[model samples]
Target chain A: MKVVCIGAGNVATHLSQALYKAGFVITQIVSRTEENAKALALSVDADWTTNPDNIEDADIYIYSVSDSALGEMIHRNPRKNGLHVHTAGSMSLSLFEGYKERGGVLYPLQTFSKGKAVNFKDIPLFIEASNADDLNVLRELASGISNKVYEASSAQRQQLHLAAVFACNFTNHLFAIAESILHEADIPFEVLRPLIQETIDKTATLSPREGQTGPAVRKDFNVMNKHLDKLTDHPEWQEIYRLLSQDIINNHRG
Target chain B: MKVVCIGAGNVATHLSQALYKAGFVITQIVSRTEENAKALALSVDADWTTNPDNIEDADIYIYSVSDSALGEMIHRNPRKNGLHVHTAGSMSLSLFEGYKERGGVLYPLQTFSKGKAVNFKDIPLFIEASNADDLNVLRELASGISNKVYEASSAQRQQLHLAAVFACNFTNHLFAIAESILHEADIPFEVLRPLIQETIDKTATLSPREGQTGPAVRKDFNVMNKHLDKLTDHPEWQEIYRLLSQDIINNHRG
Candidate 1:
């Protein structure tokens, strides 16, 4: 199938490359920036265009733009003949109301970094469509790129994205906090890498609740107080520490 | 060298086994409970003792007890002649003040769970000693099991422990939070596994700050408000989400 990607950002770059590798012919790369569009189009062996009016006819137009720009982009590139799908977790299928028969979603439930190359097969792709025919087409296209594909409504995808913010994005911010803590103490962040890795690895064998350890779970107020004292200079972090500890204590309480 | 391990919890169990494998003879397993002491002793082919008075004389004594019990455990096992140390990150080397010449620390910077087998070679072992001779002994003993060994002061080790609480313990709690969120949405936790793994793997290539991506970083209030609405039932989580998102915004503000 001929595919045209609507953005050249992280998600678009990764998704378009994955789709191209999955035997789909990327006909054009339509992005706001000529530089990014040309770079991505060159990599995928497709034509690049910045004007929405210059968008080529394709079997699929995948809108991989940001949440704020998705609606406007859809309105600008109103194509009624092809399948119009978005790659957003929070957006509804109604965004393609003009092409109601072809509107769909192909949200990959994973965080994408600029230079990172993730294995598309392992990512869980959540798909939604307005009708059975479009849903089937999405199922086949999604299964072509990923082994784990699920049909989720827009509501479920939004919840999944929120859960992901906790699991992936917010969790990463915690790592950044840890990095800053270690930096203040002149301790190399490398020392905590193994511990961080083991924390994640434990999830394979035990549930997160079952694998919990450290001062918070033990209700060691002495240690917790000492840690809070250590973070006195950073009140925000202290609050985070206190709140998270209290939550852990509450969750484990009899 | 012969070693006597106090406490039969996760750290003591893992350390004693690692010492035994490294050719150090674990002479006895000492703890308050008879069953746990006996089980660990049997695994390491050592004698088990519940009574402090019956503790064996060994070249080195390693106290792997809780923070609250470490002081009393030191008082109970007063063997001024042998080398004494602890495996606690938050504890001070002064806990062994009675054995001033031989007191030291050998803290492994990692989270240990029951039955989870971690590669000791990769774990960072933080050691501290009052005297040069004892420090050399600790360095030798630590280097035997781990490729990553460093002499960290008591204060430095305490900070490392605090940092670890954020990086490992609290991070796992976030995963638990994510799990609960998915449960409420009727979504399986398995879908987040790949995303979680990728989040960690990104740390190897990009610093946590540079790798960060999400609505909080973008300051997308619309999506953030929508997520907050979704989390209306979870007041504590709502607070957490608000605080973390605010922190991310502040940190990224240019």
Candidate 2:
């Protein structure tokens, strides 16, 4: 199938490459800068264009752009020879309300980083659309590259995105906070990697609730007091420590 | 080497089976209950004892008992022959003070569940001792089963344990909260599994800071506010969402 991928950022790079690898022809790649679009287009053997209006017709055109530019970009490109889709999790399919009768979503529920090769075969793609035919088109496109695919409405997808904040985004923040604390103490962050992997591994077998442990879950007040005391010099770390510990205890006990 | 396991709970079950698999002799399995002790002992083709006083001498005595019971358990039975080691993370090795001079720590940093099968090779064992000989003995023992072993001081191990609360325990709580929210909304919690796995996979290749994504990291106030509005009926969840979202933005912006 011929494909046109809009945007040259992380998602675009990963998605276009995966689609190309899975035997889909990337007919065109669009970006604000000619150089940006040219780079990804070259990698996928697709024609590159700086102007979105210059995008050629294809079986599917994916607007894998920022949330703010989604509506504007879709509005500017009025001619839709085929189905048009956006990859943004927060933006609804309604953004293409007047743009195309065949509009849908192809949201890959994974964080993408440029220059890294990701195996999309197992990565879940949450799809949505305004109609059944468009849904089928998007599903066929998504399922071609990945085995894990689901049809999520805007509301469900947004909730999933919110959960991703807690699970992925905020969790990474916690790691950064940990890295900062360890940095201040001259501790090597490498030591925490195995623990981090094990923590992630536990979720596969048991619910996090069942696998919960530590001073917080055990309610060891003495050890908790000592950790708090040690953090007296670092108020930010102290606040996180206290509140998270309390939250774990309260939630686990209840 | 002859090893006497001093508990038949989660740690003992896993450790004993692993030691047995590694061609080590389990001299006896000691526990308060006959069935538990016999069950573990039978796995390693060793004797079982319900009384600490009846604990047999071996090359090493691994105390995998509860943290609350460590003090009394040690007082009840002095290290008769070989080095003594306790597997508690937060507890100090000095808990065996006044006992024989061979006391040390053999704390495995992973959460162990009784019925679950854990690959000991993947578990990182944190070993510490008051003296070099004890450390080597523990090292030799730990190296038999796990490739990852580190000599961490009690203070450092305690700090690592505290950090584990954030990375492992606290992170799991966040997962639980996410699961609960999805459950409350009648959404299948399974939808988030692939995203969860990808989040962990990304952290291995990139710093958590660079890997952070979602509404908070993107600073998408519209989506954040929408999720908050949905959480209005659950004030507790709302507070958690607000606090964590703010933390994500604060950490990323800083």
Candidate 3:
């Protein structure tokens, strides 16, 4: 089936490439900039377009644009007969109203970094469609690309996305904080690699609650105060240490 | 070398087993209970003891007990000639004062769980010996069991431990929070596994700051507030969501 991908950012780049690799005909690549569109279009052996008027006949048009731009992107779409699917976690299927009768979502519940290689087969695909026929089409396409696919309503997907913000995005920020602390102390960040690996590995067998250790889980205030005092120079980090440690304490023991 | 483990908790269990496996003769396993001590003692083919008066002479006495109980455990140790070391991250070498003349610290900076096998060679071993001779002994022993061994000052190791709380302990709590969020929504926790793995994997090559992504890094407060609103049923979680995302925004663009 012919697929046209709109937007050429990280999600768009990864999703378009994966779809093309899975034998979907990437008929065109669309982006606001000619350069961005052409870069992705050339990679997928498809035509490039900057004008919304240049959009062509395709089985699906993936609006992989940002959440802020979804409305404008949908407003400019010229295709009236194709499946208008989005790759947003928080957007409702109703966004495609008056744009297309066959509206759906094919949100890949994973972070995508452009120019980085990612195997889409195991990345859980959360999909939603406005109609039965559109849902079937999405299920087939998603199944071909991924082993794990679930049809979630917009509400559930929004919650999942919020959870990802905690699980993925905030976790990465905490790592960044740890990196800064290690860098300031002239300690090699690599020293913590094994511990970090084990931290995640334990979650496979034990629940995160069961895997918790160190001062916060044990509610050792001495260690918590020491950690806070060490971060006194960075007051923001100190607050974070206090707040998160307190949360853990209250959640576990309270 | 002859050794005695003074506790049978997670760290004590793993460290004692690893030392025994590395050909150290575990002379005794000492705990408050004969049953608990004997369990570990049998695993290493060592004598078990609840009474500190029964402690035999060993080259090293490892105090792997809890932080709160370290003082009491130290007071109970009858040995006066051995090299006394601790396997605690946040503790100082001064804790060994008056307990042993040859004292030090042999902190294995990793989370240990009972019944789980972990490779000692990969786990970072942080050592802080009280003297030159004990330092050399710790260096030799730590190097024998672990490839990643570092002779760190108490201050440096404390900072490392603090950073670890952020990276390992707090990150696991975030996962627990995520699990709860997903649970309430009836979403499967496995959906976030690939994302979690990639978040850590990227940190291996990219600095965690460079690896940061999502609305927080983008300074997209619209979505951040949306997430907070979705978490209305969970006030504590909402606060965490707000605080972490705000910290990310402040750190990146500040």
Candidate 4:
């Protein structure tokens, strides 16, 4: 199979690399930036291009652009595509509306950071296509790189995207808050790592609700008040502490 | 060193087991119930008793009780001569007021769950003592079990505890929300395991701020609105989603 990856961001780099590893020939790497496109193209042994008009004929065109840039990219859509696919969890399949007969989504529900090597096989790929054939093609491509592939409708994928925000993004924000708090206290963030690892590890064996701990889950007002007082300088963090604690109480208590 | 562990809860169970593994002789296990104390005592090969009064003359007495119950427990505080410690992250070291000369806090900055075997060597142990002699004794014990041991003050330990709420408790709650959202869509929660693991694994290499990626950080109101629309039935979850997303935008954008 041949693919033309139409972005050079984290997702694009990782996705294209995974596809290349899966025996797919990335015919052309298209990005407005010369360096990023050429760099990834060199790594994947693909021809690099700065213009979408120069996109090579391929079996699949995967647009792994940012959600915000997706609109700006829609006009630059590669014309010679056998099948059009995007790797966005939030986006609808309608992004490829004009090519309704031969388009779909191969959304990988995992965070990809620049310079970080992602094990695609561990990522859960949510596949959505307009028809069975396109989906099967995407599924075949996804299955080559990943063990987890599921058929998710646009609505279901959207819900899954929201869940990803909570599971991956928001949980990460909490970790950032932890780093911030520890930074202020002159304590190393390393101290909390084991606790964080155990917290995540518990989920594989226990429900998150059942695995819940600390002041919030127990609704220990004393400890909660102490924590709130400590966050006086960080009013935004203080507000978060209050809201999440309240929600945990309502969920667990009720 | 001789020890008496008061309480048979998660913290107590894990702490006592760790102490036993470190070759400390747990002279007696004290709890309000025979079954509870005996169960833990049997595992640690120590005598069990339902009375705090029966707490032997051990070198150190570790109180691993709840935050609310700590005050009530101080009165039941085992009268020992060598040293006294509590495994609470929030409580002031002054809780060992009467034994001020020979008491401090030996807080393990990790979440303990029933039936889960935590490797103490992986957990961070925070030691705080009112005096140098008591400090060394506590440090000696803590260092034996945990590789990551630090002398943190009452205030610093309190901050660490609050940070753990964000890193562990709030993170786990977000996971619960993810599970709920997936449950509603009839999707298996296992699909999210990889995403969750990566979310955590990223923290090991990247700062949480740098690791963050989502619609919220990007301030993509279009996608956020779509998510809110999908969550119409879950107003509580919707409110949570809005607040957290807004906070993320403010923190990252500012």
- Number of the top candidate by DockQ? 1
User: Which tens-of-lDDT digit does each residue in B1-254 have in candidate 2?
Assistant: 78889889888899889989988888899899899988888889999889888777788888888877777887777455688889887788888778766789988877776576778887888899888888888898899999999887777777777766777777877888778777665677667777777767776677777777777887888778888887787676677677777877877775
Candidate 2 residue A246 C-alpha distance from true site, Å: 3.1
lDDT of 3 by residue, A7-98 (tens): 98999999888888888889999999888999999989999899888888899999988889888988888778878999898888888887
lDDT tens per residue, model 1, A1-254: 88999999999999999988998899999999999999999999999999998888888899999899998898888566789999998888888885435789999999999989999999999999989999999999999999999999989999899999999989999999999999988997778899999999999999999999999999999999999999999999999999999999999999
Candidate 4 chain A TM-score vs. reference chain A: 0.96
Segments in model 2 whose C-alpha atoms lie over 4 Å from true places: A53-59, A181-187, B79-81, B184-187
Best by TM-score: 1
Which residue pairs show backbone clashes in model 3?
A: none
lDDT per residue (tens digit) for residues B1-254 in model 3:
88888998889888888888888889999999778898999999999899888888999898999888998888888879878888888888898787668888988889887766888889889899867888999998888788888889898888899989999999999999999889888997778999999988887678888778999888777788888888888888887787888888787775
**Each predicted complex: what DockQ?**
0.87, 0.53, 0.82, 0.83
Residue-by-residue lDDT tens digits, candidate 4, B85-191: 88899999887676434778999989888977789998989999977888888889999888988999999999999999999999888889899999988887789
Rank ordering of all candidates by lDDT, starting from the highest: 1, 3, 4, 2
iRMSD, model 3, in Å: 1.0
Candidate with the larger lDDT of 1 and 3: 1
For candidate 4 chain A, the 10 contiguous residues with the lowest summed lDDT are: A72-81
Q: Write the per-residue lDDT of candidate 4 for residues A40-87, one digit (tens) a residue.
A: 999999999998778888788888887878755666664734888888
Q: Report how far off residue B207 is in candidate 3 (Å).
A: 0.9
Evaluation by DockQ, superior candidate among 2 and 3: 3
Give each candidate's interface RMSD in Å: 0.8, 2.0, 1.0, 1.0
